[model samples]
Target: MLYRLDISNILFLDIETVPEKEAFNALSEEKQLLWEQKTKYARKDEFTPAEFYERAGIWAEFGKIVCISVGYLTYTGENRNFRVTTFYGEEDKLLKEFKQLLETHFNQPKHLLCGHNAKEFDFPYIARRMVIHGIQLPYKLDLFGKKPWEIPHLDTMELWKFGDYKHYTSLKLMANVLGIPSPKDDMEGSMVRQVYYEEGDIDRIITYCELDVVTTAQVFLRLRGDALLPHDAIKKV
Candidate 1:
């Protein structure tokens, strides 16, 4: 008999960022000028700390991860099912809970963590933020010290099309190209920060995050040639 680790051991997540209020206030006049010269279109000079927080989409505001959506799917016998953990709280508290979940369920590296753009963005963002919150990170999210191109990373975008190495490819377009239904229309990533700031609504973000996780699972299973049952693995979130 053979045993296989389940996808429930994996946590699929995406992060949104916005500018930090303190960091925005601390920007020196000289640095501000240089930043303006760099991000030419950015009105960094004109933005008050409040304005910066209001406008930051994926870096400073929602970038701070006011919401973190977690999804897990695993095979049991001949069936696959998923559970979602939707969290809306301070980033530090959320990171602690997220890390704890990974640490508890995944005591070994055999249980791989999977996310769409995790290697380049999601994983690093979560790991660093965890560190900032003084939480110990799990092995799955600890890739900061690993050499580039050598770490165990499975990005859906890279794995797809054998990695064309293009400048940019959003998850929306990737899903579309692969004939998968994208969740972008639910609410654009750009609107995340605003919704979080104004309405304090995380439902949209959770929907968005869980959908990506499901789609990524599809891409992964497809790339593995449907080694898992097609119906079991392809459920829409």
Candidate 2:
């Protein structure tokens, strides 16, 4: 099925998010209570709200996107090249810029978004953050009345599932199984918040995010029985 689609029409991307505030104590009392209620079922008796705060980035209500790295393929004769660009800095600014990129270039119905577990995480998270920032949802992210078949989103992890509802696969794990290079060589997702807040290094986070996008694109190529992209073929723009 993947082989039937045109690679150039897919925009591969990944996002990095962090809790709205640097620490649990930084949240207002009302928000703190809300967070507590939000996590009660998952935290149970194992950890306090403060102790579980690090995981808040996974929830759109408590987190903010810091970076969104996107990539697309270009062809030159028989060679394929991937160019990746990142939008970072203030969340609102980056979100708007990302929205503009979609509107200006990838607005066609045939254009699709591909990422690992994106349908569950990346796609929805971006849309939620856009709404919170008062930015209009781009056509690709707005799924209100669109039929399920009309949604132009693809998830590598979901494709790997093959309808196995109980199974879950991480991008890193999938890369390993598919013989693609791992993207987590420098850091894991858990360290992103610390790197962003404490180190004040948004560049590092952007690099990490871009690598995930590259890995996802590579994974998709492998799934389609295509050869892995050479290092020289990936360009940062």
TM-score (all chains, Cα) for each model: 0.73, 0.98
Q: Per-residue lDDT for 19-107 in model 1, tens only?
A: 44334445667655544454445655676544544454343312466656666676668677765566657778877777777778755
Give one digit per residue, the lDDT tens place, for model 2 in 1-237. Answer: 889999999999999999999999999999999999999999999999999998899999999999999999999999999999999989999999999999999999999999999988999999999999889899999999999999999999999999998789998889999999775557889999999889998888888999999999999999999999999999999
Identify the candidate with maximal TM-score.
2
Q: Clash pairs of candidate 2?
A: none
Candidate 1, residue 74: lDDT: 61
Report the lDDT of model 1 for residue 93: 81
Q: Give the residue spans of candidate 1 off by over 4 A.
A: 1-9, 22-57, 60-63, 144-152, 161-163, 183-185, 227-237
Q: Candidates' lDDT values, in order?
A: 0.61, 0.94
Total clashing pairs for each candidate: 12, 0
